[model samples]
Target: MAKADNIFNIRGRLGDFIFCQRNGKTYVKRYSGGFTKAATQNHPNIKVGQERFAQVSRYVKSLKQQLQPYLWRQKDGTFHNQLMALFLQIAKNETEKTFNELIHELDSYSSLSNKSLNKNSKIDPSTLLYDAKTNKLNLGIIPYELAVKYKDMYLEVATGWYGVDGEDILLSKPNIQYIKLDKQTKNEDVIVDITPAEESQTQLPFVALAVVYTDDKGSESPHLVHTVMACFVKMRNI
Candidate 1:
C-alpha cells in the first residue's frame, strides 16, 4: 500500500480499541454486532473499544472537538493548555439554545471577542495598588517576564487612554495623565496633567501588565508584552 493508503489503515491502538488514521482523522473500529467505524476524539465515544485509558492528548483533543467552533474565539490558541479545564466545563454544560444565543450576541452586540478583549485588556490602576501604610504602589500583577527580560519594571507617570471595564484602551490619544510601566525602575513611562473631566473619568487606573508568549524559537520569551487591566479599588488623587 502507498503511504497514503497506510493513513487509512487500522494499525494503531487507542486505549482498548483500534484506531485508523483516515484522511488525517482518527476513527475507532468496532466489531461488536458487526464491522463499523465511529468518530474518535469525542467523549464517551472515545472509549468505545476499551476501558483502560486513552492518551492524554487524545482526551484533551476530544474535549476540544466537543466545543462549538465559535467558542474557539475565546482565545487565540495562546492559552490552550492552561484553559483546558475551563473549556471542558463550558462544553459540558453548553446547550444548543445557549450556545446559539451566545453566538448571536457576539455577532450583533459585542464589538470585540474574548480573544481581542484579551489583546488590549484595560489595566486596573489597582494592579499598582498604593499601600497608604507602606507608601508603595503594591504591584499586584506587574510584568514579571519584563522584569526578567529588562531586569526590572518601574512606574512612571504617562498618558494613555484606558477603559472602565479594563478590556480596551486607546493608545492613540495623547497623554491623558496616567502611570506608566517602564523598562527599568528608573525610566518613566510618563504621566501628563489631567483635566477635571479626565480626572472624573478615572474610574479604574490601568498599568502596563506583562505577559509571556511563545517566541520564534518555540520557546517562551524572557520578555513580555505589556497589557492592561482594571484595579480593584477606585481611582483617587494623590
Candidate 2:
C-alpha cells in the first residue's frame, strides 16, 4: 500500500501505541520484527536508572572478608563501588531489598538527584518519523505556534547501533536542528514546523520528544489530527 502523506490517516487513541504510514514507509514497528532491539533499548529513562539500585542487592551476597581485597576500607569512610559488596551485607534482607532504601545507600556514597529527574515530564515523548536513509525525523506537520513556542525544546533522538535499551545507547547530537514547520517545507524555523539536523537522522526504531525547561522538565505531544498534525520521528524498513 502507498504510504499516506498525512499523519491523520493513521489514527489511534491517546494510550494506543500504533504504527502510521508516511510517504512510502512506516514507523519502526515492533510487530514487523525490524528495529525491535532499538525500540526496546530506547526504554523509558526510569527503567535505565533502576540498574543503580540493582547493584546494591548483588553486593549483599559476598562476604566482607571476600571483598576486602577490592572492597577495602578507605580512609574517607564513605562507601565505594568496590566496598559496596562488603558493606551491603549488613542489610537484614539480602534478597528482599527494595530500591527505595538502596537509593539512600547510593546517595550517601555518591551524588543523587534531589528531585526526580523528570517528575513533570511525560513518561513517553511525542512520537515522530525517523528517516533511516537520512538519519533525520520527519516531524510531518505541527502547529506553527507550537514550533515557535517550543523551538528551544529538544528531540533526544537516539542514533547508532541499538544497545541494552537506552542505558547503553549512544545519544544522537544533543539538539536536533529545526526549520519552519510549514506546508512549503523550506527548511527554516519560522512559525510553522521544526526540522532536525539533516545529517543526524538514523534508522533507529523509536524516539522521545520533549519540551525541556531550564529545570530539565520535558513534555511530549507526538501526534495530531488533520491540519496541525504532528507525527513522531520513528524508523522502520517496512
Ten contiguous residues minimizing lDDT sum, candidate 2:
223-232
Q: For each candidate in the order shown, give its overall lDDT on alpha carbons.
A: 0.32, 0.33
TM-score of each prediction: 0.24, 0.26
User: Each model's number of backbone clashes?
Assistant: 17, 27
True-vs-predicted CA distance for residue 26, candidate 2, Å: 70
Q: Which ranges in model 2 have alpha carbons more than 4 Å from their true place?
A: 1-119, 122-127, 143-169, 180-233
lDDT of 1 by residue, 17-83 (tens): 6666656755675433433355444456455323222222344454234322212223334434533
Candidate 1 lDDT score relative to the true structure: 0.32
- Rate residue 17 of model 2 by lDDT: 45
Model 2, span 166-219: residue lDDT tens: 112222333333333223333432221223333222222322233333223233
